[model samples]
Target: MFFLPLVPINSTTTLGRQSQYPNSWDVVRHFGIRLSDCFVVTQFSADPRPTTASDALPAPRLIALDWGTTSCRAYLLGPDGLVIETRSNGKGILQLSADPATKDAEFAAELTRLCGDWIHEAPHLPLLACGMIGSNQGWAEAGYAPLPSRIMAKGPALTPVETRQGILHIAPGLVKDAGADDHGLPDVIRGEETQLRGILSGKESPASSIIVLPGTHTKWVLLDEDEVLDFTTSMTGELYSLLIHHSILGRHSIPPRHPDEAAFLRGVDVGIGTESQEEGRPGLLTALFSARSLAMTNDLTADAVQDYVSGLLIGSEVAGFTRRWVGRTSTQEPPRPSITICANPSLASRYKRAFLRLGIRVNTAADDTTAKGLWHTAVLSGLLAKEKA
Candidate 1:
């Protein structure tokens, strides 16, 4: 139902004895944050709380907080979702003490530092939060809502934690019941609730849609109107990154630039091709050989080689999903689900072009589609009431 892709950034290099977020590792972390397989960190901000008690000045309606693994993102949204101001802090859930002894205190302190002033402005104003802050490792595990239930469903709500500053609501990640399906399906997602909700909010009456959220573990979410129907995951992005940058494939090719359409599409072509291999399909090895082989054997250009590499990754992803779709058990005609690609514009644009070129129609959702969807779901389901500005 609700689709949220969780992609963890792998940090193989250990931080030296610097007692600090090491610069070299930090670059990796920054790259990991940007190229994170799980979630995306778009912008960061810090804004002072309103202090004037004048009746003419009203406090912000609700604060949309996306407290993730590596960062805390807070948005002071107006009644219409227009951001009045935003704030962020380096204190993410991972940084919180998992030891349990100091977790609560540290979590509270981080929240206070980031939002205490804002709470003073509107002590009674409601707050909505989503992401890992509510996961098993978070301050509190906000239990999941079941299939066909929208993100804002009343089935399982956020676990509220009260502090001297104000009340904090932590969004729960969706987790399927054990043995829900074969392979002991243990599907769970943290930060994607808002994104899925944002997608539903765009429509007057949500249709039966299948959203493809491409990343480390690509999520294929099936939605029936506002309700989440079912879902599955694919390790597309993570595999590509690992094979190209770290694994054996790295021996051959150069690093790729961000927004490299040529490389991305090239990956799609090779990966999605029917004849990849039955034996482990050493995608990286094949891609490496393709590049080196091209250089050694013929007079191919660097750009062409890059394109070939990209095709290998994307091609694999497409091919895998195609198998899942076609091999799915059903006597009925294939689900007439619209493919909505929810991701960054650049990625979405590339996917749009690629899918189109392959005769697949995909509608690209807005950039902030996830956050907005979460807010709208909350409002529609009365998990959050519409603000009166």
Candidate 2:
């Protein structure tokens, strides 16, 4: 429903970097895909005019939104892209009205409810959004962009919704090579792409790197020269949740939080296939059972099992990805990448530990990368110069 028929047009495009095109119609014609088809979307709007010298000047503040599956988050960003203030609507796409017809209206209403006061205060500030808010199931079906391409070269899929405040620009999600996936889970990322953009904005080299963004569904991205070379996804956090609380293996006491660093590292070792000595090492499913086995049998403490299990899952994700990408040995030997971890402090620490365990050097990205990323995309697309829609 969000495709919009690739019709002929004279209006502006939401796609950010492909500035040569006179309109979104021309932009799509040049690229052969809708911005949404190329990426995904939440929504946003621009002034529909070219950015001027003044528009290019550093802005005092802007709105950076990370609207995902579990929640809607807004950040009031300073000109340098640091967070000035934050607002959260503990609701995500899943929390919207179920009926399709009313969903669009709710998207507007919910965002207004979440950031209405801020919008009222700063009437013309551009609003940039990423994540599920742009999916087919979300406000608009801003298509998907294929991988091995410039992540921000093209702006976002412009899905603008009208409201009393202004237009909400839904960003696009990127889809991996359609031909590569035979079993059908073509790699795709919505919000992470924006976060990666934010990360690159701060770095000197546009050269490629192994950047990992950890979350409910963690993303491992290979960015090259401002392009998204490729990526993969793992349901690390979700798996931890299901295994530790929903499955039989999790049918034990779980404290709210615990230290248990030793047990966690041990779990990481197991996940990396180093902790086990048995000739026939157990698989993850079988290894998961040990959380309960050890707890019930007094091998793992009740307080430590949860963190240990978490370590195992995260460690496995990191190790598996490393083996596939970082460990590949070719005759020419590709240059070793500088692995950067972008996540909240806790998750970043876990991932950094995992990489270090295998001797991989890493750097942690600032926690505000997502917010800054929103800013970068907005500037690239000339959104800040525009008036409220």
Candidate 3:
């Protein structure tokens, strides 16, 4: 049996209004590709034709998209899954109209506004998407794929949504059942599985590895080769946002002009109990108040308070995860698995620092995994015709 958490998108949720039509030149410049290059085509005939210089260049094959809660990213993938061009906007699911009467229309309009040109130029190419766009509150619910499954397998079906442009195929999220064991809690993952598929396609390692995706709800996935053995999620990022915006801890915080590394590391030490003088050190609950008290006492600057609190939350999350998953005994400790962080550079750097402080070295995966994952999935699922040698 498979189940997914259906968190409805609040109609009042506001991520700020985005322009209905984005500037095309700006998009081309941002993605570093020519506007004309995106629409190039090579006509074929029954008569034998010699390959031209243009024919040697990779041609667009798939229109891949990663549509999440707060943003949407579209990619034009060429032969062998190379990205030819890309576009992004703030028109996520949360930005759509809350009225059920017009929600579907809004989504369709957003999709066309985002990449209607690509769809128009490459009508022969297939469209594939992965992310919250497949959620219950999204344009359509793609459902969930059961656990103990191969990440690249094509058994589970992709949900198809009809639109003015074409039929968009949405990949299903993954769901794990609660077993009668230590790691029995049920969990669900949307979009990250495609990123995992992208990561595994590039590198092959015999030993197991941990893939950490940092965001509002961070996912710490356990990957054993091509299969995901188990995983866990932490709401550290969301908690930090709430504390900095809604809680008393953020009352005095003024955004720092520059990041305070010293203050952040200090908070990390406190949260991890490394700064504790006594054997019975106070835990995270007690440590959290220090953010407010230290600011009031002038021991910590108003500017540095936010970073300090961020480090504290992240440190506590990392410490808790290691304790639960990486076992330690009196005699000896088990070998830690290799960790690969898949995130933006800033977040990845922060996580790398946290892991390094604990003497664990980790690698950051490429930024194009989502696009590559979508292309790979489309190819594996028989959406694309086999390329001629």
lDDT agreement with native, every candidate: 0.59, 0.69, 0.74
lDDT digits (tens) for residues 1-389 of candidate 2 = 12222222221222232233325434443555422233212223353333233233122357767888889888765454645446665478888958888887887888788777557656667787888888877877666777676755656555665666688787788888645432655678888888888888855644657888898898988877778877888899888888777876667756646567898898888787733334887777777777777888898877788878888887778877877667632224433776889988988999888777776767898777777678777766667544211
Off by over 4 Å in 1: 1-58, 88-90, 152-156, 178-182, 256-261, 274-310, 326-335, 377-389
Ranked candidates (TM-score, high to low): 3, 2, 1
TM-score of every model versus the real structure: 0.71, 0.77, 0.82
**Residue pairs with backbone atoms closer than 3 Å in model 3 (clashes):** none
| Deviation (Å) of 153 in candidate 3 | 4.6
User: Candidate 3, which ten residues in sequence have the lowest lDDT sum?
Assistant: 1-10
Candidates 1 and 2 compared: the better one by TM-score is 2
Q: What's each prediction's clash count? A: 26, 26, 0
> Cα RMSD to native, each candidate?
12.7, 13.8, 10.4
Question: Tens-digit lDDT track for model 3 on 263-311?
Answer: 8888887776733335888878889999999988999999999989888
Arrange candidates, best lDDT first. Answer: 3, 2, 1
